[model samples]
Target: MITRRRSHLRAWALLGALLGATGTAWPAEAHQARAQAPALCTSSREPALAARMSQDIAAALKDRDGTVSVAVHDPGRGLRCRLGDTRLYDSASIAKVLILQAVLGRAEELGRAPTRLEAQRMKAMITRSDNTAATDLWQKLSRARLNRVLREAGAQDTVLGHDRYWGLTRTTARDQLALLAAVSRRTQALDLMGQVVSSQAWGVTAGAPRTVKVHLKNGWLPRATHEWRVHSIGIARGTGTTGTAAVDYRLALLSHDNPTMRYGVRTLEGVALAVHRGLAGGTAARGFTPGHRISETPDGSVPSGAPGPLPPAPPHPPQEWGTFPGTVPPSRTARDRRRAPRRPRSRPSE
Candidate 1:
């Protein structure tokens, strides 16, 4: 019996020594589970308001993975909150809004209205998150022109994509806030953004009071490296006492490395809900309700076999910009088959 006990003890000791040599052989996901949550960094002139927002935002992001950046501005209240607002992420379809700004700015510069083709593409690009339409506009506007618009908007932290991959452009929450402010003040882009297809209007609107007019743009793209980059920016106009212009507020939320698109959307909505509630003096607002009807399609109907709950394709294809004409191009699947299988290229998340 002593010898048997000795053998068992020796076996246990060997196992312990092996484990110690290798440290703990935990699975990758176990390490991820043990990772610390992100810290919320926020500031506002209104100390009480700032405290509330910081607490609310931190609570909303508790235990969530990935990185999220947010910036909020309420001019009437002189309130602002920024949490990781300067961190950059791939812009995805959100860049389409900037493209719209470029298109309008260029038209204003040239002292001409958008041509019929330009109007059509702009409509498709913003309202529907249409990649082909965005590509058409991106090619026409060129990188130099888009960069010029970014500069004019005072969005210093934004970087346009290399070549045709507009979705790959990098931007920060603070930069997006600048873009939102520009849209709010300018009529051209603001008018088109107001018509954002109901199906695509889920982010900032989720937390806003129903009476407020919401102009929003959302971008979502999934990549092998980041899992998903999802972003939303908007201007909200609150209903005030009659005979007064509504109090306008702007918010920008950018996130990357989300486990899924829905998770990212939920995170954004949570942040929005908190901000709107704080801005509205703790009044509760309606949550996100997807529109039954899809907008911006050829027939304004949801395409058959569309991925449920996933964001639409981003504003550029995986390939370089070719000779795109004014007309809307074919769907991605058809285009892929027509071309020779080039080397496997990184697909655009948007």
Candidate 2:
């Protein structure tokens, strides 16, 4: 009898050990997973808001390819949300924003606004996303000068691109958000960003209510490694709404490893929309009307030979917003061609 009782005890202990190893024990596999997975997003001011944003962000990213990072801030609401780590990515045309900031910083030291030449460069760099303007400003400032501005802005993790290739500077979403706060402190900076041409204002600005003024900048690049890098940073200031109803916030969304430019843009916008909704006190996210998807123009302009007429391209075929759309669109002529069809090739004197 004693031997049988001991044998039964030994079997029970062995079974318990196996169940625990497989996570099939009383605590349950689901519980173990929940414990192991860290929160993707967090809000310092509101836990419920953080939880909601985290869940929605995770849902939006389900099955989505590539690596993404995000940061959201609303000082008035005392809410902040962060997702992903501080992995670095190419700055692309987003360097235009940094260059403008550095110029403005220098002007501030001189106790004046941008010089006429600097003003022109700022307008082209921010509003038109012009590379020549960016390069001119970047070259005018020594690397030490630019680094000084970045350090003042609290962008500790950013490293400027080498050899005047300003677009290749490496940065993280956190650093971008910091730069935004620093830049926005100046009305001149805010005004320039707010005036970004309509064609270039799609990323963090997507699905935002017109009531909230959006000041934004976006960047995209393609390299042999990682394939593509796309990023957007914006401040959504709700001047029209009052109290808790206001949706005033700033967001930085960065991504890489996309298979194509359009893919990267879609990922950034999807995450942007998610952040917007999450920041709106958990309101339902608005849809980003399926317009045209832009193509490979990392300089934030229309590339040669896109599918349809650009900028306000046609509404059919459901294209993604790109750095081009994230910044130019197809021309009216391109749209006309896609709609009318190629009237069949002429045989001529064959």
- Using all chains and alpha carbons, the TM-scores for the candidates as numbered come to 0.69, 0.72
The prediction achieving the highest TM-score against the true structure is: 2
Candidate 2, residues 220-306, lDDT tens digits: the string is 777656667777888887643234475667789888777777777776777777677766533323455244646576663223232
What is candidate 2's TM-score against the reference? 0.72
Provide the overall lDDT of each model, using Cα atoms, as 2-decimal numbers.
0.71, 0.71
Please report how far candidate 2 places residue 293 from its true position, in Å: 4.6
Give the TM-score comparing model 1 with the true structure, all chains together: 0.69
Point out the worst 10-residue segment of candidate 1 by lDDT: 294-303
How accurate locally is residue 125 in candidate 1, as Cα lDDT from 0 to 100?
88
RMSD values for the candidates in order, in angstroms, are: 18.2, 22.1
Record all residue pairs in model 1 with backbone atoms less than 3 Å apart, i.e. clashing: 221-349, 313-350, 314-350
lDDT, residue 336, candidate 2: 73
Runs of candidate 2 exceeding 4 Å displacement? 1-33, 239-246, 281-286, 289-293, 300-350
